[model samples]
Target: MSVSSLALAQTLLNGALLGCLFGSIALGLSVKWGHLGVADFFHLSLTLLGAYLTYSLVTELLWDPFLTLAVTVPAFFVVGVGVQYLFHLIDAQPFTTLLITFALFIVTESVVSMIWSPDLLNLRPLLADGFTTSIRLPDPLPRLAVQPIDLVALVCAALMVGLATYALRSTRAGRAVQAMRQDAAIAETLGVRVLPLTLAVSGLAAATAAVAGMVVSLRMPLTPTLPLQWIGVVVVATMLGGLGRPLGALVAAVVLMMIQNAWSLWFPPQWAPAVTFGVLFLFLALQPLTRLARERITSGRTA
Candidate 1:
């Protein structure tokens, strides 16, 4: 197939927008995994729940879709706290939280399936056609363009990253959360109140998930279980971005999307995933080895 320059530009733009969406979806995962030290399998389910809530309220009650965040975020925040407390009650090890969260994921998925049905669900924005409007730049390819919705998603990604970065860096609670991330027992010894911090972090992550789900629903049609597709995005972007760093995830997402789209252009779409994962595995594998080598070199020099 002959690829037009305009078409390629459009493709790149789509990738950029998708990267933002994926980053936002993965932000909660990064938080819970990096800081809380919990294998939060239910993170995507929280996002899907947010979308379903927004769709139901906006469609049935005629409320503004974004306005639904007021409801979804807080509710999910409480849900996060409750789930965290349940984990605490079970005295589950950090790794074992993976199994607990998986159970939660299954339950949330079933609830969504029951309430929203197994069929496709979508949110209708007020400016549906307006979002589709693309701009043309004067040049060799006048039609090399992008939709406003993509830009909106990019902006939202920026805001989410910035907010998360600031929260983790500036606030006392956030600092305690970070402390716990580094070492839960050590943080507790320092009076960080590990459980409370865990609950707070969990709640904030869930609220972020709600925002991500809302942004996602705004951009495309969705299904109750579509959040599952986000697993790769969450894992790859979070690992690429660096654990516990929202800013890293944002930049990584953009880079990942750019590379993935470029690879797709020169190869079969199926091979693109192989390339994407191959790169991720190589990157992940090298990280620890490089760190170990650097530490050994430092020790030798000191000796």
Candidate 2:
């Protein structure tokens, strides 16, 4: 299985592009988990729903795929806010939120399956007529083909991360979000508008999911169960990157995608998932040791 240099480069490029979309999908989950302490597993399902919606809009309505974002983002934002309100109404704990959202995930998956009929859907046909022109690399990198939608997804993912970072760092609402994450009761006592901030962040996170889903529709075929494959890797990436850290999530996802691509070069495609969960298990196994080492070092310094 000798691979050419050009082939390897192209593989890596595709992996990176896909990783960017993965980062986009994970961003909303990371934000909600980090800030709101709600492990909204259903975020992935929402993303799939967004993809299905994008497919219908593009193929049936003859709209540009990217144009669907204008509709999905705001609609999903409202959905996110409503979901958050449900959490609040129930006063759900972290574990409870997980169960509730997982239930929602199942329901969403079922609904999408019912509506979309478990068929594999994509925007490729709609994009075939001059919409998705591929770009060629120049000189030393000639023959490396870059799909337009792949590039678009990469750019959109980066932009979403940047926007989320800016919102978190530069705005009053962001500071409120940070404070609330640290301690909701304390933040509330300190005059931070925790409720409104929670709703806003949740909505923003859902909006990110919508963008991610729209990108996914442009880049790959859609199915109701698509989220199952993504949920594990994205969740691992989100956790390893730290909750609410959009940039960290993006970097982790890209690296993971690269590793998976490299692994696929030598191994079977079915074995690729081993790479994702293997990294996850390795990280989880190391966490205790890492924490203990830090604790011992702190005690030694105190001595």
Candidate 3:
């Protein structure tokens, strides 16, 4: 229970909390891009919008962090719907959707700069006063301190992911959405409304993004350029997590964060992201080989 050990433990806890926040944002992207066959390249813009809007409402109207959700969640959902409708109108191919959404990301970032003037903004912590508490460690050890707000955020993210997973598994609508993701034509023939289902899924994804954005705003400073940073991390998380699995996304976020943090401690800051990307590349290269091996084993068993 040395002071250095205590410090390292606290840092790990903090990293886990931040990792949850990353997963929260990635969850929506996983659903949209992984499940629904949407490119959803603008997820970062949606997050930045939520963060910026939360900051504005909290600062101007004296809204609480929770209350800001009333404004942000619905607004982002509507935006999601509108964006989907626009995409439908364009009738873009999958790669085209990626290009289109990336373009939208640029436009949204520009809009954010125009409205917020590229300034950094942060919301007041929701539980500013009672957020941090200390607990005594054993004798000859430094006391441990925890931030309740960070813990709360982590718990909330876990709950949201659990609820979403349950909904997808247990509800008729959720099952229908899943079916559509696999085969839209077949699902449509089976009485699923593909258009409405896509809209609902997109809205849900955007709502989750809004929640993540608000939490991020409370925890860190926001800027117009922040969305680009989130996009890069989220893309990596989504890929490493196997695309559609929320749990996988959570695990990937933690792994990536740990790698980055551990590397940064040992090497220069510039090398951290490179190290992380290298690890991700290795994972990506192995995925298809692993899948092929599984498929061959299954076929041999059948034979």
Candidate 4:
């Protein structure tokens, strides 16, 4: 393959694969903001927390960081439940909740800095070293390169998607969660255990964040502040993907990453934040018209 062709192929493949990371990163925020109606500005902090916890445990106990999920997931679950209860107690408006979460994030970030100091923490998991795999193409195609860490992340993301689908579509508790998401009063009137279900969903969200962070940490260095950038990526993805639809969010995440990959060719990767935000701005600007068109189409179909 020609240089340009190979580069294009790599670009497309990475964009798509990288989106699994993106979608997973946003899963926690998606559940909270998209499903639970909590626009949690500090959702990214959960990822940071997950990364820090895994790193701390691995360093302290000499265990595979991957093995740390047994601890991280449960710890974050409890944290989420506690946070959700606080939100309920305050009966915070959306904007206020955003502020509250952001404040909590600042506090958490400070604690992390105090413990870990101001340094970029990167790890080369024993599992990821020399973990490259290549597949030969049959005649008209170029060989493709793959990484184990990325594969692990992709598999994890796919599993999360499956679990999310089953929970939202096939379970009674999931239905009640969705019902509450759409209208809390109506869901409660329908005998949905709104409080318990909300706590469960919030806990699920935090667990997803932990998984996302653990995967990303395997491939890169982490820091207390690193999740700040992730916030933009995941939030843009959540909105683009369809706030309340997990599968839709994954598809949208992939599409957005594809566009960002294209943008990267023109500019440095650092501009990714700008690219994502720009795409989100355009999407939001057009959302009202899109919603109206959809409503009209629905009415037409029914008529």
Best-performing candidate as measured by TM-score: 2
**Candidate order by TM-score, highest to lowest?**
2, 4, 3, 1
- Residue pairs in steric clash, candidate 4? 122-221
Q: Candidate 2, residues 1-303: lDDT per residue as tens digits?
A: 898887788889888888999998888988999988988889999999898999999888998777888999999999999999998899888999999999999999999989889888767876764547888877887889888887888899889998898989898888888888888899999999888888988898998888888888888888889999998789988988888898899888988998899889878978998898899899999999999999999999999
Is 3 or 4 the stronger prediction by lDDT? 4
Each prediction's TM-score against the native? Answer: 0.88, 0.94, 0.89, 0.90
Instruction: Output the lDDT of residue 92, model 3.
Output: 62
Q: Is candidate 1 or candidate 2 better by TM-score?
A: 2
Total clashing residue pairs per candidate?
A: 0, 0, 0, 1
Task: Estimate, for each residue in 1-303, the C-alpha lDDT of model 3 and write its tens digit.
Answer: 234665566666666777788888888888888777776878878888887888788888877777989888888889888877777788767788888888988999999999999877656543356543534445654565546656666876797788777877789998997898889899999899998888888888888888988887777788888876666567788888877777778778877876776555556778766776788788879989999999999999999
Per-candidate Cα lDDT values, in order, are 0.81, 0.88, 0.78, 0.80
> Taking the tens digit of each residue's C-alpha lDDT, what string does model 4 give over 1-303?
234767767787778777888788777777788778887766688888788877777777877877899998998899899999998999878888888898998998998899888698866644434544444445666466656667777898899977897888889888887888889999899899888888999988888888987877776787788867667777888887777677777777888888888777767878877988998899889989999999999999999
Tens digits of per-residue lDDT for model 1 on 1-303?
678776677778678788898888778888888887776879888888877787778788988767888899899899889988988899878778998888888898889888788987666445457766776656876767766767778887889889889989998888888788778789899998988878888888888889887777777777867866667667788888888888888777877787788778877877665665787989978989999999999999999
Please estimate how well model 3 matches the true structure, expressed as its whole-model Cα lDDT.
0.78
Selected candidate, larger lDDT, 1 vs 3? 1
The better-scoring model by TM-score among 2 and 3 is: 2
Model 1 Cα displacement at 72 (Å)? 0.6
The parts of candidate 2 lying over 4 Å away from their true place are 292-303
